[model samples]
Target chain A: MIVTPWKVSGDVDYNRLIERFGTRPLIRGLLDRLGRHAGHLHLQLRRGIFFSHRDLDWWLDMYEAGQPVGLYTGRGPSGPVHLGHLLPWFFTKYLQDAFGAELYFQMTDDEKFLIHPDLSLDDTVGYTYENALDLIACGLDPEKTHIISDVNNIGHLYKLALRVAKRVTYSTIKAVFGLTDSDNIGIIWFPAIQAVPCFIQSAREGRNVAVLIPAAIDQDPYWRMTRDIAEKLGYYKPAQMHAKFLPGLGRGGKMSASMPETAIFTIDPPEAAAKKVMSAFTGGRPTVREQQELGGDPSICTIYAYYYYLFEEDDAKLAKLERDCRSGAIICGECKARLAEIIKRFLADFQRKREKARDLLDQFLLK
Target chain B: MIVTPWKVSGDVDYNRLIERFGTRPLIRGLLDRLGRHAGHLHLQLRRGIFFSHRDLDWWLDMYEAGQPVGLYTGRGPSGPVHLGHLLPWFFTKYLQDAFGAELYFQMTDDEKFLIHPDLSLDDTVGYTYENALDLIACGLDPEKTHIISDVNNIGHLYKLALRVAKRVTYSTIKAVFGLTDSDNIGIIWFPAIQAVPCFIQSAREGRNVAVLIPAAIDQDPYWRMTRDIAEKLGYYKPAQMHAKFLPGLGRGGKMSASMPETAIFTIDPPEAAAKKVMSAFTGGRPTVREQQELGGDPSICTIYAYYYYLFEEDDAKLAKLERDCRSGAIICGECKARLAEIIKRFLADFQRKREKARDLLDQFLLK
Candidate 1:
């Protein structure tokens, strides 16, 4: 399946996408190399969720050589923040703590308004604040993180957008985004806005600073274009770490805000989240007795996938759960109940942090 | 024969352009209608230099009904402000003086930087200040004028540009500017920047105000697109008054800074202006004895055009000059000398005004 900035569809093949995108695999030993500098590898990195990269080794080399590196990642605030949205941000927090790098968290309110005809500026801006609370709850340091909404901080971005826009051609955007004549000019122009943050720190410091972007693979196209023009604009090409998508609860595709029932929003109450988890699709036999006699497939089960992706951090415990399911020792009902309890506990903690984040919002906002 | 926002070429037929663009001609009685409010018609209107319009009568009607009206005009700042560039600004000043309207003068430094690959942002912004001096020398009221360069005043313009950019589509800009796939994305996005000034006053005032633009026919495309989507955005449709181009010296087409010797810049010293005037092309017989027998054709003469357009505003004096030339009573050498004296006199006064304009620049800048 093809992954552009706006679309993610089909049964995505991660190994094939890495080859197609011409990015290097995050090899086994690279985590150890990163651990040497970071003190430890992030769960996402250790579990192979962040499986592909471009020029990351060079960026780490620069950091080890006592050069500056900044991190950039963003959210498109069309709706509430979902679990899918938090995956990269959590890793970003890890990177920040590990490398002591400054982070630029962009809320692309302008992008949402341009791509979605039904969304007004006010609507997207409201979502930006809601999404920002989730980012703050992810444990990023307020002093090192600069959370910027496109509309609120446009004064800092307009000049850089102009510089990037002047270099990118209409043909390039069309090929990258599948834009046609019917697309709004704002959409045609938005690539420049997305590209600006990659170099903004370098521009602000009046010198070249290596930019490292840790984001989902769906956003790779924007960085691909940014990387192509970065050196030409007198900055280092931004290095990217691509993360795998968290699948939707009910279906085969990634968790998306467009499908509310299939995604767990951070704002969802505990009861609602537990209900969704209980109803989520799983790979099991027709009957519990049949599943006890014939083993279920944990590899394709959403409950098992959730635990593997986020819930269970202990490798031995996760391996035991996978073995029990394959051996027909655990049933789907028990697995769902256990997953719901884990989710409820996680949400309880997250909700408290989110409330605390509200008071610190001003500190992280880019003025 | 064709005129778009980015290109103007061939021997343009004004009447045909008016027909093709679906604009109304500024007929004889409209000047008299304007005279009722303005006290007297400006020289450009009297000489039919302000030849065409779109919704101008409606704007005047709004003025008569006691509605607020604002004037908008702009420069590309790619080079020096030549005679062709000043034609519309002078007319804009006339409108501002007549109606006590606020003026928004945009210096499109960003546009020039995007369209001209060799021109840097510094180059275009440098030209903006030089062009602003020429605009101020044209006798505009500094208190009523707001001079904005795209880069300097982008903080005020970015939100409005986003609003404008969202409404326009890629096909519309491509059609209006003849942009190809190879054109930079900045050029594709620039129409929104150009369109922002038209509604800026209304946006700032928090109410609709009638906007009237005075510009050459080459800029008509921008207004055409602006007018189409204005009502959809809940703003008044902007009115436009189109002026005829000033012919270049020794040429059949408009005066342009690209052809340096053929254009007279506002910053040109009196001696240089006289030199250019002396070498100007004129309609005359080969010999003085033959010119006495065969009359010159003022219809195609650049020297005669200068007097009609700018120099000789007096009806009686201009009529006599035309009659004498047609009667073979005025020789080419004598005509050139008279034109040179007028140009020198005009430049001497303008240079002093331009020098004073530098001091008042802060008053006109939109911060």
Candidate 2:
């Protein structure tokens, strides 16, 4: 299984990912401690969608002891936001509310421009503005949330990035990202820019403040590199809660915007998104006759995974749907039709909120 | 000869440097062309101290055709400003005055902080302020000159730097700078920062502006790299006029601030500076009896070179001094004592101007 911040393919083994990324799995005991500190557990945590962590317990411990902790997550604005991109952002919003934490939403517009051969700075920055609306739709409190665009907010970020760059050797960058002499210098220099928000709070406040990064496990390498030099630079190593990727509606792989049929983009018309869900891959028998006799497997069904990952918030209702699918009480066509309507409704609401978000965009941006 | 932006050693052959740097020699024809255009030649150009050119003809061609051209040069503010550091700045002032071009004086404080292992950001930034005073003391027109501190003006420069970085590969930087994977990421990223001012005017004016860089020949590599990408980025290729180095007071190398006795720093007390000139290495026979018959070698004299490089502006006076030294008519002690007074008087006046520069510093600074 391969996973990187830029690419993800093949069938990922979540258990193996924990070891490969060198992150601690969010075990039951830690989850209990987290639930107690947060007062109410986020759905992603309760369902183990956020499966791994780095120093997360310490962040919660700080919160328990009455110290303020911060939340940071980023989106690379190369294209339209899709459901797969929202996994961590949704969790981030939940944390902001539960922990009463200040939030920093970083838009990696520069990264998107440098990495995409055809993209101009204007294209990426345009996408940054488009993507920020979706982030606002995630229900993050505007009062505490600040969206930071790398290109626009670079005046403040560049200074902090320099401190990070000073300590990082090219060898470390090469080893961490598998970059070589042929790579463009912009990408080679970008990890330091990516590491900025990890220390931004402390840099601004003139005092130490704990920070937590909620992102996909694919991004753990960046945090690992940041952790190595964080304390040396007089800032706390940022804590992280790593979430699992939401599988595409296709048979396999993480949902990507490149394959429009396999992923539902936020900007896609609600009807178009609903059509995508109806044709999604599912683990069912070839015929209805065989499905009723042998029963279907919910474990490998993309439709079931979607509900478990995003749609079905009520645990009892979700479990009942899973059981009914496995017991053949729910057939593939009927289940898909229901899931499609659920998605359509969610998208319709999201699009409305996203439109309303434009009014609040300027206020939510970090100057 | 060994020369990189950070290091210069051995006896430099100025003629050989043209071929090595892939630049054309500033022949008599080009000098004549320049004199006619500017109405006169700067002292450095008149004496062949400004020895090489790259696209300087094209820049002048544009000027003759009534298109505006610009000027750029930089300082790595790692320490106190010394006489050797003034070579290019003085010539830059001449270009700004003669050509009536806007000048960009880049202070590479970020580069200094990153490259020097023991330096803090504060140290390099602090030195940037000290060095800016000396730049103003060079008599650059505050009305047309801009002092760009890399750290302070990074809001404008980093965007341009990123564009440079996008086109450059790590292999190119490694080959041009001899940087390796062992170097800090900040240093690996710095060539782009250094290349920014070459394109700054074009970026700021929202149109093409031909730029000229005046610098010691050791910094030719940066300009070569910048010239390679200039046309690709939609700006006129920056032209360069490379200058020969001023020798140290005591030894066989460029005047270096690290060796306090070998360089005359602007901040050095006038009497202490006079003492340094008194003990300066010079062309003289061991004894007065041997000196009369054998004479002396003015060609190898550090003291005579100093006068030729900075102190003596009159070509006739400089030639007469050189002839007297070679004829043993000018004794080393008598010549040094006289040169000491000239430097002492020059410094006393310079110190006054340097202090007055504080009043003009903010005006010269690029926000």
Candidate 3:
């Protein structure tokens, strides 16, 4: 129902969330406008998973006007990279290729350490490197992307973070994040670090540059705070495109690394991924006989949702699968087996790229 | 009067402050212990200017046992470096020379920017370089001293600041610094940056080393928080040597750059120093005849306190001046003129050294 930076529970209503967040829907006209510049729209955009935006049109206007525009997206490296983590990054890579924009990929290892008491800096940094491989495996150009870990590129971030931090009050953070006085000071301070990337390019280049962030809706709060202070700090407010979360393989809710069985990590081997997909919850009836009579609900089916989200990129094939599920032409067992094959094949290719990404790490790394 | 990191007002009682801060008085035995290693006691110790300490004996124990110890002190570069700012730094240099310890002189440019919204980062950074010249002019050995500014050396500080920030809570900082929710998040996060220099040497040296901070009593609150989490973070609780504030020329309390006419800066020329001293608050009676007839109260005099703190180092001469002022043997104008000469002489040497310090800036700067 509601999404914040830290929590994602209940079944989200995307249209209601769009109104609540005061963002514009990615209507067909806007997609056509973006397509004019991008040559072709990304599948996520075409499918409407990236369904809402704040100032995206303004960023596009700047791009069309021949002004510089940069891309920013980040990961909180508290654990292994999951498929959910890769969703927005792949879209970001698509934007980078289309616009030929410089991408600042921040790895928020410091935020993870501050938020999780049990996690050490070393643990978060280890996760950062592992997650970086997944990002590289997404095929973002190394020369075009700058991978920055908050702990590693702190020199670049800290000064800008201080500028942002100086403009924000404790009350503002408390209100935005619902933080209590008992929260660690790092938690209170970290939003500033996250906001730094939005203006870092302008700071480095000595000129105003528009920033576009492609991320899941959970990350919108950081941008909200960043937008509030952007003009005051002599930088443009960063534009954002919010993507709907990929649902968990469980009964409901978004996929999370914390729920190991409900989420598939990028690092998970083919066998492990298949095992997870095989055990996923579905929208079929209690009995196979009842399912044959009433038919399955593909709208609520996790297996079909996977196809809608990522696996089945071909629109015609995805539509047929959805129609067949609803018509009871395909059973849960057959659907599950087919989804497992696609995921295993995807993982096989991803694992190979992830391994090769290890050597290219330095090229993408921000010193 | 009470002194925390945020508040410093009223006439302070050194003994009461020592008790309130839960620190030990630097008694004769500890001075004797230090003298055995230092060869001779500095004037600050001899005259009881550096009067209070926290765990100084523990630091001494570490030093006596042949383990490394570091000296940390800092300046909030809000404006020009005045005599009050130099007092602790000079003593810190004394400690460095005596113990052969590394000195970390932090220029808190980010703190200045956060605390004063009207001031820009450029302004604070400008003051940082200016103040670094003053610190260098104090004759701190560049070979052993590392000068770091929060804005400039943030890369080195950010990771460590994050660790300290995680351990500290908003309530803790609020209580320590009298912070309210209205305060900027930067101010709330700043104590962590200040705390970093205390542990940076140990972090770099790959072994736990004792740290001793020399600063005015106002700065003790930061060390209190640092001490609280040092053991939890696997570092020694940094020791502190608190100095009495150098009185402003106009009246009681510390000399601050904010009150320009009251504080003689190291950059102030001879004429300006003379003008400030001539208008300074003194112990003498209303008129020359009244002062001759009735004695003065040197105890409450800012001019006399200045001499006691830095200018008059010789015990006999300082005692004679105090006795003469109380015995109606000296007039305010003549006393002011004499004090002005000493300050002018000190500033003359300081200015020359400051000019030379520009050439040696790189040697002391921690980039």
Best by TM-score: 2
lDDT of every model, 2 decimals: 0.89, 0.88, 0.90
The candidate that wins on DockQ is 3
Model 1 per-residue lDDT tens digits across residues A183-298: 98888999999999899899988988998999999888898889889988899999999999999997688998889998998989988999999999998888999899988998
Candidate 3 regions exceeding 4 Å error are none
Shift of residue B262 alpha carbon in model 3, Å: 1.2
Instruction: Give the CA lDDT, 0 to 100, for residue B247 in model 2.
Output: 86
Q: State the weakest 10-residue window (summed lDDT) of model 1 chain B.
A: B1-10
List fnat per candidate, in order.
Answer: 0.80, 0.76, 0.94
Candidate 3 chain B, run of 10 with poorest lDDT: B1-10
Question: Which candidate would rank higher by DockQ, 1 or 2?
Answer: 2
List the TM-score for candidate 1's chain B. 0.98
Q: Which CAPRI quality tier does the interface of model 2 achieve?
A: medium
Residue A138, model 2: Cα distance from true site in angstroms: 1.3
On the 0 to 100 scale, the lDDT of residue A168 in model 3 is 94
CA RMSD, predictions in order:
1.6, 1.3, 1.6
